[model samples]
Target: MVIVLKNQLRIVKKNIRQFIENITSLFSSKISDLLLAILLIPYLISKVGIENYGRYVFALSLTLFLVNIINYGFDLSAVRELAKNRHKPKMLKKLLNKVLSVKLYLTILMLVILFVVVFTIPLLRVEKTMYFFALFLIIGDLFSLRWFFMGIEKMKYIPIINVGSKLLYVFLVIIFIKQSEDYEIIILLEGIGLFIVNIFSFLYIVRKKRIRIKLISFYKVKCPVLK
Candidate 1:
């Protein structure tokens, strides 16, 4: 019985180590992202000039607003669901699919509304492409699946992937942006880089056993209205 107890204690310690590691990965990713943002902003402003840069910022804000609408509280909610139902991979897979589908529908609807608002507003209409490209940031988020990794306590090392992608974005900007006309590249980089990292995160789940994905009936889920 003492041997049994010793084995169990070791298992518990290993689990604790993994959980702490996951949390550390999350904080490290956040800090790196913050630092990257700080470093990139000045170079971007210098390249685009104040006026164009200001316009880009405005466009990002609008896109961010729409992104939040699509995400809503799914991060917390899905994490809760996973935490409760974890251990049952089959069930967790269904819930993940349902949540992703619901998010996709919301994203499409929100995009439609965003376009309508952008086109209808005479002032915003001029920068419609910029606003629309920024939408890719959110679209890329579809693949992030952060809640999945968080719930699983795997974290999947976002800091490494995110920082790598951001560095590429920085490189692209430095090489391409010599004038105001190149300002559009900024949005493009955001879109492309976000997708790259998010795709990396998603594949980490799908390819490895880090997490599982399965098809499930949407009707089984009582998804909130943009469902």
Candidate 2:
């Protein structure tokens, strides 16, 4: 019937509009990240000197190496599973609980490995403090609801959350970092920025999406491991 066709057309148009909005927001956020990085990197490099900058990079790189290991490729799986079941609120909550539980276990295991590597490696041992500071990055990343929002195909809030946190980070860095000794604050800022953005995003989801994150047992279903 014509009414059925009209309804379908309206739905299609609405979805298209939403898709465009999501893309625009995501793009803008990415641009902001790039611009912020471009502005900060030169100032940081010159302020800290080459040797200190290298050390900081080395520490962050080592930390991110663990990140790759900790993630263990759950990103795609989470997006697929969550996105497929986005319409069902109960299912979304259940999936989120399971994902968080599994990720927590994974984090514990990865952290054990991380500390082992940090203690054994000479480079990491020297930068032990920074290495430890960078570990919070993993926690920040894990708690980030980026996958959840991406699954639901809602991206408007991400830009706001990301930019706000980054702005604060920039402010802190500018105010506090003056010389090489202050380079430790850089990694901490990265971790803090991630933590803050995720906190904002998580709270937004809880309030606006009406999703509760409770500790649920994964015993009933076969839980998927990151490995």
Candidate 3:
């Protein structure tokens, strides 16, 4: 009886530790995102000028819309799958890979569609180039390593990477804005920053967590579809 009680207590303690770690990591990452957003708004507005800033914002809005269309709610679904099969690392990996594969294919299709729309729509013609390039941001957000962290519930590293990347981006933006007032430069910076951050985080997860998609391992499962 005492042994059983001790084992339960130990398990509880471990869970609590993990919970605290995840929370702390999330907090750190959010703080970084908050700071970056705050700094980016002023820097972007000031560097690009009000008129160009509005155009940039419009392009960004379009990019986000396309990103959502491409994502088709797979991000949340992947996380849920991971949570459901937390005990089975192999299963989680399979699920994650399948979802990722689907997302990648969808993203490519969306990009092509968006490219067509950007060229065909008269109103979007002026900002077409910018919007096209903005696809990188959408891809970055979709493939963000943060999703994997959320799935595995080992979120401590996410915030660290997220925050560090945002800070580095902010620094780069400052340097660029100091030298020029080109709105395209600012927009490019934003897209590139997001790409770099996501890539870095994804690489970190792959290297440290050994998260990978094995095409043969994935089995058909009714994954919860999120809207």
Candidate 4:
């Protein structure tokens, strides 16, 4: 009975440790996101002038709508799937591949749609470059594997890479953005940071985590969408 109790206590301690780590990492990432908004957004508004800033925000809103269409609730569903299959290497790889493949297809379709809409709308046509630049945000999100890490309950890397990338973005903005004209590059700067960090994180997951991404057939990819 004493030995059994000791084993149970050990399990409890391990679970508690994991819970604390997850909470701490989540908190750190959220704080960094908040800081990015609080610290950089006002600076951007000031440097870019209200008119240009308003245009950027308007373009951003449009991009976000496409982002949602591409996302299609995979962020939540994939996390649940990953949690279930994390220990099963074959299943996990297949599932991950399906999700990635589907998301890639969706992104491409959205990009084309965005191109059409931006060109069709006379108002959006004026700052079409900004709209196209904002498309990179979708691409950046495409490569982000925060859902995978969260599924495995290893949240540490999310905050580290997130904070690093945001810091890089802030630094680049401060150095390059001198006047309202520079507002055009603001989204592009963010895209650069996201690409650098997310690509690194994706490679890290592949090499360090030993998870490989393979392309599957449309038939295999079709079921995930229905589910």
The RMSD of every model to the true structure, in order and in angstroms, is: 2.9, 2.5, 3.5, 1.7
Query: How far out, in Å, is residue 136 in model 1?
Result: 1.9
lDDT (tens digit, per residue) of candidate 3 on 1-227: 99999999999999999999988887877877887788688867776778888877888787778777766555577677677787887776666667666666667777888789888988887766677667767777756656667877878778776766567667777887762246655556676777787777767666665876453322332233221
The best candidate by lDDT is 4
List model 4 lDDT by residue over 41-63, tens digit each.
88998999999988878877877
**Count of backbone clashes, every candidate in sequence:** 0, 0, 0, 0
The positional error of residue 164 in candidate 1, measured at the CA in angstroms, is: 3.0
Candidate 2, residues 1-227, lDDT tens digits: the string is 99999999999999999999999989999999999989988989988888888888887887777777656656688778888888888888887777777777667777888889889998778878877888778788777776677788877877887888789788878887898898876888888878887877777777886777776455632356422
On residues 1-227, what C-alpha lDDT tens digit does candidate 1 reach at each position? 99999999999999999988987898888898899889988888887898999888887887778888877787787788787877887766676777777777777788888889989999999887777677778788777777776777667566777777788778778887898877766787787877888887778666764445554445644446223
lDDT for 135 in candidate 1 is 76
- State how far residue 161 of model 4 sits from its true place (Å): 1.9
Alpha-carbon local distance difference test for all models: 0.77, 0.79, 0.71, 0.84
Segments in model 4 whose C-alpha atoms lie over 4 Å from true places: 225-227
TM-score pick, better of 1 and 3: 1
Per-prediction TM-score to the true structure, in the order listed: 0.86, 0.89, 0.82, 0.93
